[model samples]
Target: MLRSTGSSALNFGEAQGANTDKDYINKASISLKEFKESRVNLKILSKVDYGNASRRVELLDELEQLIRIIATIIKNKK
Candidate 1:
């Protein structure tokens, strides 16, 4: 999940350097998908792997916020 999550940002950064609309759209779409998956995996991981619910919730909140920010950027991109 972390790999995908980070790769999404990395790919998107590359897309920003793309020379064509098609390339930008393709990379942005993949980034959006990866971000969503990462958000979901974080939820599952926090529940199934955490020994401390409070810490898990905190981390979940942070990851969710970051995901939302990324999603919003993807959505707003022209």
Candidate 2:
């Protein structure tokens, strides 16, 4: 999900025009939604002892960072 959003932003950077910006913003927004959903699911899994607690914490932290980064990109594009 992070890679997809990053790729969309990178492609926008390589292109020239307003349309690219809108496209990137749209794609990144969708990716952001999915990332958020994943975060929710991760939280649920953690409650059930689906993985190492430490590792789950690490992943949740990383996912939050990615979400913020993608949100920043979308904001700046607008």
Best by lDDT: 1
Assess each prediction's global lDDT (C-alpha) against the native: 0.74, 0.71
Query: How many pairs in model 1 have backbone atoms within 3 A of each other, for residues 3 or more apart or on separate chains, i.e. clashes?
Result: 0
Per-candidate TM-score against the hidden true structure: 0.66, 0.74
Give per-residue CA lDDT, model 2, range 13-71, as digits (tens).
44334357777677667767767777877788798989689988998898789789878
Maximum-TM-score candidate:
2
Worst 10 residues of 2 by lDDT: 9-18
Cα lDDT of model 1 by residue, 1-78, tens digit: 669778877987987888876677678778777777777877787768746778767767876776676567656665
**lDDT, residue 33, model 1:** 78
